[model samples]
Target: MPVVLLLDIDDVLVLPVGYKRGIPATLETFTRRLGWEIPLPTEADIEWFEAAGVTSEWDSTAICLAGLLLEAARLDERWIVPDFDEAMDRLAARALDGAQIRPDYVAWVKQAGEATRLGERPSQAALRLWQREVLPQLPRSEALAALLSALLATTHSLSCPTTAVFQTWMVGSRAYEEAYGRPAPVEVPQGLLEQDQPLLTRDGARALTAVWYEGRLAPAFYTSRPSRPPLKEPPPPLPVYSPEAELAARLVRLEDWPPVGLGRLFWLAEAVGLHENPTKPHLIHGMAAFAAAIASVDGIIEIQALQSAYETLQAGELKGPLAEWAEFPWHVVLVEDSVKGILGVFRTVRRLYELGMSVRLTVFGIAPHPGPKAEALEAYVDRLVPSVNDAIEEIVHLCREG
Candidate 1:
C-alpha cells in the first residue's frame, strides 16, 4: 500500500530550538518550525504514526527521514520499498519528545470536548481528556502512538490523501453519543474525540468543519480578521538565485525586464519544461510557460518576442483567481485537441477571454478565460473542448495575453 504522509501539525519543527531557546510560546513556534499544522490526532490513532516511525515531542512529531531533509540532502520520508526481500532498512530517525502543543489549539479542542458530552457533543470529552491528561504523561513516543490511534480510529480520511488531511470539530453530538455513549473513550486522553463521532472531511459536510492546512495556516482564517498589514518597511528583495545555484544569473533577471525574442523564449520554455516534466507529457505543457516567458522578456515588441516573453512570466503571481474561475459550478474541464498547432492555445484563451467566457485552461501552460459571458462559455465547451487535432495551436491561442 502506498502510505499517506499526512501530519498532525503541518509545521513539525521547533521554533525555539533554532534561537538556542526552548519552544516558542505560541503556535508561532509550530508555524516557524513546521510551516503548517496538519491535524491534531487523538490518543487511539497513534499506531499509524508509530508504524511510520513518527514520534511526537510535546511540540512536534519527528520523522526518521526528516533528518536528511533537515541536512539538505534528501526528501525520501516514506517507508522505502524493498526489492525482492531486501527488507527496507530504516532511515535516520529524529527525536520527537520534550516539546509543547500549540497553546491556542490545545484550548479550542478542549473547550469543544468539555462543553459537549463524552459521546454527546461534536468532538466529545474523550478527545479533550487525551489532550489534557494522557498527552502530558506519555513520553513523546507513547503520546504519538496513543494520539495517532485515537485520531485514526475516527478521523482518518480516505478521500483526501497525500499531505492533505480533512478534520472537523464538534461534529454530530447526537450521532457521537449514539456511537460512543461516552464523553470521551477510555483509550483516548482528555480532549481526543471518542469513537462513534462524525469525522469531518469536506467543507460541505454538515457535521464536520472543513479545514485546509497547506504551508500557511491562514486559510483557516481566510474569512476572518484582516491579515497583518504589509510590512511598514517592506523587506528588501533578496536575490532569487543563489550564487551556487548553478543557473546563470541571466536567467534570474526577469524581475525587472520583459523577456522578448526567440533566444529568451526558448529559455523560458526550458525553465517550465524543467518544472513540469517529471515525465514526457509535460514537455508539451511547458510550451505555455515558454510562450508567456517570451512575452515577458525585456525589450519586446513583436510576435516573435512572444516565445521569450512566455518563458519569463512567473506563474504563481498570475495564478490567483484563476483557481477560483476553475471552480465555476457550470464549467467542466475538457481537453481540446484542435487547440494545438504550435501556439494555438495562446490564441484560444485570448479569444475565449475576449468573448467574455471564463475558460479554465492549462495547455502548454495553465491559463484561464479571465471572465466570459455565460452562454458563450457553455457553447464553447460543448463545441470546442476535447479535441485531439489542434493541441499546440489551440493552447497557444488559449494562453495568449488578453
Candidate 2:
C-alpha cells in the first residue's frame, strides 16, 4: 500500500515568520489607527489560542479586536462603540482615537471561547455568544449591535478591512494589489511573507523527495493558508500571488506536491455549499487532502479531480468513478505541530472507517518544547517528535517495516 503523508506547513516544514509577525503587526496597525494602544498578544497567548483551535491568524486578529470592543462596551463609560464602517472611516481619516485597552479583554475572550466550544469559526462563535448573552445587558445601543454584526462578518466577508490589511501585511503591498485586484488598504513597503524561514533541513527535504519519487509515499500539503481558486483549466495568466502554502512548499523544495488549502475549501463551500471552513481540526480538510494525495499517486494532478474525489468521500459513496482509485488497506500519516490539526487527522481516520474505507492513520506531532502545546498534542498524536526531520525518519522506518 502506498503511504499518504498529509503535511502541515507552519512549524512543521516552516517557521511561519510571516504569519506570526504579521498577526501582531496587524493588531498593532489596528490599535495605532484607533489609538486604542492595546497590547499585542504574546507568543504564549498565541500558543494558547492555537491549542484552543483558533489557528487562523485572521480569526486571532478579530478575536483581539472584538475582545477590546466587548470590554469597552462593558466598562468604558465615555466612549461608545461605533459600527464597523464609522470606526473604519475615523481610523482612515485619523480623526479621533481612544486610550489603552487592558489585557482583561483577552482573558474574557478565552473564557468565552472555551464556553462556546470554539466551533468551526471560533472568533465568530465567541463574539456572537458575547453579543447575544452579554451585549443585551450592556445599555442597548444600535451602534453596539451594528459593531457586533460587523465583527462577526469579518470571516464571513472577503471585503472586510481587517482581512484586507492582514493579507497585505502577509503578501506585501504590491502582491496584495496583484492578487486582490485593488491597491492595499494599508501602506507597507515590503511583505512579511518573504521573512518566513524553512524548518526542513536539506537532507530531510531530500529524503522526503527521494521517498516520493520511489512511489513509496504520496505527499501533499494540508494547510490553512490561503490559496488561489482550484480551477480545471486556469485562465490566460497564472496568479502571481502564489498561495501561502505554495510559498512554504518552495522553501522546502516540495513545490510540486499537491496542496489542499483554504482557498480550495472556500471555493468548495461556494460551489457546493459544503461548509465555510473545513480547515484543520475539521475532518473535511484531511479528507480533501487525502483525496488529493490519492489523485497525485495516480498521476492525476488537476485540482478538479481532487475535488471530485473529496466530494465522493464526503458523500460516503465508495463505488463511484471518482473514487475508483481509492481502495482498501490504506496507510495514512499526518505530520503536524498544532494539537487541533493532529486531532483533525484523528477524526478523519475515524470518519474513513465509518464510511467503510480501510485506512490506518498515524499522527506525528512536532512539539520541541515542554509546554501547553506539547502536553496537549501528546494526548492525540501517536508519536511526539522534536522536529519534522525526526518524524520523517520514523515514517521511512515505518514504510520499510512493511
Candidate 3:
C-alpha cells in the first residue's frame, strides 16, 4: 500500500508561535465582547504560559484566560472562603490522614496547585463563578473554531481524505459541557465538499471529524476521569516482512496515491504516526491491526495503552504477527511536535520495527529554535527537520538512497 503519511496539526501544520501574541488579542476580544475589563498578560506571564505548555501541565492559555476572568470578576473573598479553602484544606488533610482522595478532588487540587505555581490563586468560588457566569458567557467554541479557521486560512489545506483529532482535558470537564453543547462523536460531515463549496467552513468540516472527551489519549493530568478500559489479552508478536514484490503490488492497488505522484514516487513512502485520528475511516482498520498486535491488552483503543503495547514489542517481549497485518504500510513517515505526539510517534516507530518496516520520523520542532526536549527526540526519530517542507525533502533523499 502507499505509505501512510501521518501529520500532526499543532506546531507541524499550524505553527503556534503566534499563541503568545494571540493570548492578549483573545483576552481583549473577551473583554470587549463580555464588557469585562481583563488585564493583559505580561511577557513573564507568556513565558510561564509557554513553559507550562511544554511541560503539558494544563491548557496554559485557557487557564490564563480563566485567571484573567477571575480577576475581572473581583468577587468578594466571602465567596472564596468556605468552599475554596475548606475543600482544599480538606483534601490536604485527607492526604495527610492517608485517606483516598476522590478523582475530582485530586483534579481540583492539582489545578489549584498549578494556579499557585503560576502566581494566581483561583479559589473554588472563582472556579464556580467562572463556570456559572463567565465560561458560559464566553464564546468558547466559536473562539476555538475561529482560531482553527484562521490557521487553515494561512496554510495549504488538505484535499485528500483528512481528519482532525483533538485531545483536550477541558472537553472532559463539566465546565466544558456546560459551556459548549455535548461533545461531538466520531463522524465525518455530510456534504463537506458539496457543489464545489464545503457546507461547513473548512474548519467546521474538520471539526465534525473531531473526537473529544477521550482524555485517555492525552497526558494523565489533563483528564479528571480515567477513560482507559482494562486489558484482556496479551499482544501478539510482530509478523515477518512481506516480500518486496508483494509490498510493491499492494502499493499499485491503492488508488489514493495518484499515478503522477507514483511516477515521481521514490521507493519509500511517507506515513504519519498519529496520536489520534478518530475521524479517519481507516482508523478502525489500523486499530484492528494494533489490537491484533496486542491481543493480550484491553484498551488498545486508548493511546496510552497502545503506546505501552509498542514498548512491549520494542523490548522483544512481544513477537510479530506481521502476517496478520501484512498490508500494513512500510517506509512510512511520521511527524510530531508535542510531548504526547512525540510519544505516539515513538511507539509507531517500535511497531514498524516489529513489522520489519522502515520509518522516516521527522520532529518539526515547535519553533525554528527548539529547546532540549525537541533535540532529545533525535534519539528516537530517524530525522529531525526544521519544518514539514524539509521533512518532505528528507523523504525524497531517502527514496533516492534506496
Candidate 2: tens digits of C-alpha lDDT, residues 1-402: 668899999889999888888778987887776666656887778777776667777777777776766665565433454657665554445433354446553465466446544235776676667767777778645677677656655553545556777888987888777766777788988989889898999999888888888878878888888765577544222221247887888899989887778766666666666644567766667777877777777766456555664676567765343456546567899998887777777877777677677788888888878887788789888899889988778788666564
Error of 3 at 382 (Å): 4.9
Best by TM-score: 2
* Between candidates 1 and 3, the TM-score winner: 3
Better of 1 and 2 by lDDT: 2
- Reference-based lDDT, residue 107, model 3: 33
Candidate 1 Cα errors over 4 Å, as ranges: 1-310, 315-402
TM-score of the candidate numbered 3?
0.36
Cα deviation of 140, candidate 1, in Å: 20
| Residue-by-residue lDDT tens digits, candidate 1, 1-402 | 000011011111011121111112222222324333333343322222211212122212211111112221113323222221111122223222213222233343333323432112222233444446544543443434343333322221111111011111112224323323333111111211222221112222211111111111000000000111112333121111111111111222211222112122223334446432111112222223223322322223323333322332334212322222223311112232111111233443453344343543332211122222122233333333211222324322322311
- Please give the TM-score that candidate 1 achieves against the real structure: 0.16
lDDT of each: 0.24, 0.71, 0.31
Model 3 misplaced regions, further than 4 Å: 1-4, 15-25, 29-58, 69-75, 78-324, 327-329, 351-366, 370-383
